[model samples]
Target: MTKIGKLYGVGVGPGDPELLTMKAMRILREAHRVVAPVSSDSAEGRAESIVRRAIPDVTIERVLISMSPQPVQGRDSAPTGGTSADQGGGTDGYHSKDSGYERAARAITTWLEAGEDVAFVTLGDPHIYSTFTSIAAAVIRMLPVVEIETVEGIMAFQSLAARTSTTVCDAEESLTLVTAIRDTSALERHLTDGTTAIVVYKGGSRLPEIASLLRDTGRSKGAVAGELIGLAGERVTSLDNDEELPSSYLSTVLIPSRSMTKTVEAGEGPA
Candidate 1:
């Protein structure tokens, strides 16, 4: 049997093809197989989107992991449009990432068993709210001999802060990073504890609710919204309360770590 290949989890950054790290680029260039994640909501894969542009000349076998928030409607049938890999065809009754942990693990295992290096591409950094970590854990159990490597990429919060020219922290200031949700209880908790700067990632669709949540806390005026970070059609909207909030899952909200101290420091203001 051929030696098992290594599995690498690479953070491709947030939508910016240029933001892909040198290490990630090198691995993608040299890897024998690559698995790009495609969300259940859309056929388009942001990780694959960046990969296609960044390494136009590279060639490798690739797989698509469709992670759906809910059970996929079609578990037995192949998808209408996409390669076999895109279809995620499996003998087992697994369809979406939610139920396809074993399938994904087996898929990566197949490549590794062939002595092929595999790179699992993810958006932004893998450590912060990424699916790669979860999938990797399952894959490891399936293939105990497989080696796993993790590469860091620029995070959405860091990119958002840079694009808006806002300072995330100023020496000794603590920052809260969490997912944006409709419920304001979490936001209320942070504010109650005197937290100032918060980076809400992956909740672009909840902008209005987020805006309202901030308004309830009287922190709506200084909030900043970043969408599509380094990619085209990027928008950075600054709110001052009472303004309409647009929706985009690619969106990120930046709130000053505190009241009366956080103002726009500088960078590209509003798209």
Candidate 2:
């Protein structure tokens, strides 16, 4: 019997090639062809760079995906005078209506159908807000029996903690991971609700508002504000009171829980 081709979705980690997990690196080097999403300008693929640095010998295939989310019109949707097209087209001014992953799914499935082992490389972990989820969903829907594998890479949160020398959370404390860029109110609630640590994943576009909000909350408790942790370029400042915050895609804000106060006050540091 012929062996069924398998698809491996590998996370390459944030920028650093050495951060790749052993399993991810192994699959990238062993896979028949590696795939990465590219920009409309056809510039070098971001995720591809990380993988190439780790396994430079692997053959790579570029799969272009639109970074924009699809705009859906619901029955109860407010009547905007303009359609999605009026919003200046999709990312890179490409007016193509099809979601990028839809195209990516078909491309991946075609490779699998050809009996080739394909590896889809993603920055950070494949499951953590990566576009691989949609592409994988498409593959499974078309070929239910398609073999799939996922290899975890270092998440931005962990990387941020390492860069800032900050503890994400101890065994005795809880960590709440949130993507609060889209929801300011939710983020405010978490900051004040006494979460052991608040790790915000996507804070690029909403940095200004999030910073201001955090600054106010930290002022009452004399907590530092606007801390952007991760990588050598990390900007870990008190956003609650800082005048400026450095920019980065791998940014994460850590709000340590009150339980850590005793240890901190004792000059004992993180648990």
Candidate 3:
């Protein structure tokens, strides 16, 4: 009965390999096991993608917790094709009624119970809109004895700003990042509120709605689209008009909090 080393939930950042911090790389390369989340049993895993891009040759064991088709299809299965097979080979989809967080906790507890250290990698900073928080919460309640550590990484919003030469905020300003779907109804409130900047975390399908909202509120000039920032397919499209955003999930829109005021103060053209 050996005591297991701690579990490290490492943030791999948006999608760029260079964004990986040295400490995160060091922990990932040395971890005994790595866990990632998957949307479907058939979809590619984001955490694993980060690991492969950072340290392709590491030979640690891999675990995956599928996020959809609730009632977690497989909890005990062997890793196959760089992924895990379901309880019945591949027929049953891997998901859980308890959501991805619970399934991940079960997997991690199994490793911890066996005296094994594990690392769960996530995209972007764990504290910043990452799913690692849900997994962390579950682990704390169910496997209280297991030690947990977190390693932060560059945030997607920061990376996106860097790639586009857009200033997220100055020392005199502040910012708020929210998921697209979660904050739709607050559109009017946020516009009137003094939150320096609003970073719509996922603006794919919401792109049109967002564009419409901005136009209707007369804030279209402050809106811009950033997709796959820091990755190979990165695209930064500025929308001075409301009809040009391409459909994309990795997309985000930035609306300066006092866009009109800023324009007036600087005597600059709108957006």
What tens-digit string does per-residue lDDT give for candidate 2 at 238-269? 55454576444445565566655445546777
- Candidate number with the higher TM-score (1 or 3): 1
Query: Compared with the true structure, what per-residue lDDT tens digits does model 1 show for residues 82-105?
Result: 212221222122235445556667
Model 3 TM-score (2 dp): 0.78
- Displacement of residue 247 (Cα, Å) in model 2 is 4.3
User: What is the TM-score of each predicted model, taking all chains together?
Assistant: 0.81, 0.80, 0.78
> In candidate 1, which residue ranges exceed 4 Å CA deviation?
40-42, 60-62, 71-98, 241-243, 259-271
Off by over 4 Å in 2: 74-97, 219-240, 247-250, 261-268
| lDDT, residue 73, model 2 | 50
Who wins the lDDT comparison? 1
lDDT by candidate, in order shown: 0.67, 0.63, 0.64
Q: How well does candidate 3 score on lDDT at residue 113? A: 74
